[model samples]
Target: MMKKLFLFFKALLTSLLLSACCELNTDNIVYIVSTNDMHANVLNHNKQIDLALISGLKKHYDALLFDAGDAVQGAPLAALSDGDDVISLMNAAGYDAMTLGNHEFDYGQNKLFEHAASANFLTLCSNVYKDKKPLLNNLNLPNEGRYAVFNKNGFKIGVFALTTVQTLQSTDYRLLNTLNFENEVKSAKKMLDLLRPLKLDAIILLAHLGCDDAPCTSKNLALALTGVYQDELDLIIDGHSHQEYVKHVNGITISQTGSRLKQVGLNVLNFKASEKPQVKSILLTYEDLLSKGIKPDAQTEELEQKFRHKQNKILQQEIISLPFTLYGGEQYGIDLSRVTETPAGDLAADAIMYALKTKISSNFLKFPAVAIQNGGNIRVNLGPGAVTYASTLYFEPFLNTLTSKLVSPKILYDIFEHSYRYLNNLSAAGTLQNIKDSGGFLQISGLKIILDPNSKPKVKAIFLDGETTALSRYDTKRKIILAGNDFILSGSDGYSILKDIPTLTEFSDEQDALISYLKHLKENDGFTQYLKAQGRISYTQLPKSVSAYVKIRNFHQQNKKLKFHCSVDGEKFLPCFADKNGLLKFELAPGDHILQIAEATQEIYLNTILGIGIKQGSNLSTIPAVELMPTKE
Candidate 1:
């Protein structure tokens, strides 16, 4: 009996040990969702992202949502409330965590904190602090640089957040007075020390340092992360570079969904807690929860609608009567670039620039120049219709103030070098292409140059107050004052080509400028005028030589096998016109000639190559004789 009792107790002990070990091995599956660089479009896409998230919450009840900052500025709605309404919406969306993006400082920290009260999410950033406390108060949670721990099916997890150092460099709201972003990795280590004691299952770093594709942003930050004391950090949810990724680097998996609530980085990390912890498999996936078929949450939709009506009331008031529809007028197909003929772009730029000049005339600046961004940036097209204040506000919603800086001649040259990209593909052929590759540098109102499309960018001549002058005669010996918005002057378009420029010289508040300009118009006999291009630009072609074996294909598909036709001063040479199948061959000796390709029946000129060179060497060929569309004359 004693022997049997000993055996029974041993068996029972073994079974219990096995059962306890299996219980400890259970998983804690956590879904991490993150967003970054979301410039608040609260009334439009912001609401869209929120509704999409609410939809996500229904699907993944246990997922944690984090917004990586740059969330409150850029659009008019958020700017109007100074981010208070967006905070209310964010709280409604149940955001779990967030960090301040650079733009957050646009209004300064005091407003940010007041708005923070409106956020239901956990405000975090290991970098910035005031009086030894995180810049944001109510961080009752320990700041030991440790993670926020959550229990899931008997598993322990931790999450932390980081911001970029550039946040301090912005003049948005003057943060240099207090906080500073120390090296990200240094703070990460201090937090790791605190986390080490917890014996956590996995660590997640919510990063806001935007990454680039080449000299990667996240990868660069991750290199810093290698110095971190903890080995348990298995995942990094990154933002900043406004990029998308689903990959692992240096043993840690980093993921970021593209910005503006387009998608959320959804990651599933499997962990094993043993004598030593290890990550099994990290699967990254993006949930395009923002689809048409998916209905938005009823509660979120109701809140968005409430704000939409109020915003519409303010945006719907008529502001002006435009002579022609512009910014892609729906049925009218009007172009803003036709600003000379259509009063839309010209009128808007005039109003804004005039208001700014009037506001800042105390300085002896003369003949101010104003330039708007490219055509693609013009989102809405107006028609011969009553322009509403909302439409104007919506079209130019950034609310950017007018600013100027004294740029050195050398620096201005560098800036112009890059800005030539804008002039290279102008829609109007008659528009001056004479701007040397280096010439289109100046975005101004007091000058104009005629450009030939067929030739390189060499200024034919420039007109200043209707008097033509050779451009080469003018040099950068004198400083030319320029005016533009903060975004433009900042060289946002890789045109950091301007030098000797002050950071930001705010002259007139954007909204104030608009209002003042509008009132000025109401006072000045309703301001009637439009700008039109007053110059001729064309490409003259000359063929140097044409040898035997010159080949041509159908200019158009209809006459596929037709013989090719070449014209030298209106005289036909070659195997003449091809048949319906436009295919032609030519043989000729070296000579000066004009080559023109004409369609068989339409009688439209397909292409004219002036000054084309066929070397005296051997034979030459033109297999595909098609050409780009003609520029607007």
Candidate 2:
């Protein structure tokens, strides 16, 4: 009788344990591992391997790994394999998911699709769409999904990803023409709503928007999605803008690891299946991980060594002696050459024109008038001595077509205006400033530009190549001026003024043009490169005077008389009136300024022709009408 009673109790306990579901689970745990903006530094970076061991993840909790984007656009290793090695390493490291960052599209859309398809883990994003249909799902990438759910001990955790909307501006605009990204705030709401009816215990949003991108960053995302208080989100993983922070905001936990495998984030999820989950996060910095005595991942280390050995064999082959140090990547580091000018900038612009002259019949528009290169086009710096193929290619990485078009002085003025427009600001784009605000800082080989921040026509004067026919009578001459480079000819990088210009012809790739020029220099013994200003480009303070043209549009139909006052440089408003054409025109002191116009209860910021500063003008100048919106509570 005693033995039968013991057996009956054991059977009942087994039954109770077997029937328990995720809906009534008593314990659940998992770990989230993420990397962002590695930029393919495979040989130099191997921290991800040790991070796994340092976190002690596999021992006590389930692990899920993810990458927030920008995995494969820089460094020679990534360039040679087009990210195949990156994919293999990520697979071996056991990444569970990833989302596309802007640089993923650097190799073009089709190749990017291939990279996404080839990955072992899911490539996720909730807002990318093509032809109004979802892109991540329609691409049919085997592991890709809009959102994912993982179950641990019968407890389900839902997750989704979002790329920055600025992606279109940040990536090659031409390649992503067919795709569109939605506003992040609205997209997040939609994703959460779709996952609401599921049996999820918590939701996690892994975002690439960070603290620097602004209005679209993680902090802003939290403000928009959760308002002043946290509601549905349990944790947020973020990347992009390359910052590091581990903090709890608005009752929600947020974490980010810096780029290039500099750090790894470990978020420990502590939960009961039926209640709101709690999160604890710790950042494993590179130094800290090293101090833990966690050995470098052997597999990744081997992979990196193989890549370096292969890459060095080709990259180190001597091409030519630099003679002098060539510098670039001044402001953004590994991107733009600089806002003003540099030796590397001169070399690139001169190389293009030199190649065209020697090649002949390269009439971009009846033979080119000038050769221009975007500063953002130059990458990395090279010191004096033997330069290798690998090093050369690293400096001039992206595959941009060499194209040209004829532009008028008026439009050319707009280009210069765009260049100097960033004179006052340095954060978002100290060098380039379109929506993405990059690569438009100009370095020219055929002309000189004099920019006066105080004038309406900021370009005070233009001088022909060799400094002949100095900007005198330049405005009077609208001679069809030829300029090169697809980034400019196609009107990217705040060059909207040239978008409509017809392409006369497209030639060899930019890299090839540079190589030809380098070889020609080698043959002629002209390797002692020299680029003095010769007054080609000058940066000066306030001009003698400045002018403004302002127009008011009544969208809400509140006023007709347009009664208003004007202010200069944030000063007190003085009484002002519109001209016969319903336009307000005025002049003020020239250096840097702020123009505001107020009528009745409404006020608007007036951006003049040629913007902020320009030489006074009235003919054919289109006044930029800035619309003012009401502030929200």
On lDDT, the leading prediction is 2
Candidate 2 wrongly placed segments (more than 4 Å) = 1-27, 45-62, 139-144, 226-230, 272-274, 317-342, 348-386, 393-633
Tens-digit lDDT string for candidate 1 (28-76):
4455556666656544442345533443443453556667776786554
lDDT of 2 by residue, 1-633 (tens): 999999788556434422332112235655666677676654553334332342233222346777788787655566667667777767655677788877777667778778777887778888888778777665675324688887756668888888888665444356677898988888888888888888588788888787663348777777776642257888888876556777777666888877666677767666744478778666665554445444555565566677678877867777788644555544222233445555577778888777555543433236327778887778775546787777777778764556556666666666777876654421111111222234677878788887654456567777666655554434535664454676667677778877766554444346656766777878998655432222246645434444655555442343334445776544688987765555666775422233566543333222221242221355424453444344344
For all candidates, the clash counts are: 40, 10
User: Each candidate: what lDDT?
Assistant: 0.50, 0.62
lDDT of 2 at 404: 55
- In Å, residue 484's CA in model 1 sits off its true spot by 9.8
The ten-residue window of minimal lDDT in model 2 covers 426-435
Off by over 4 Å in 1: 1-27, 42-49, 52-55, 58-61, 137-147, 171-176, 213-216, 227-230, 272-287, 290-295, 317-372, 379-389, 393-450, 458-633
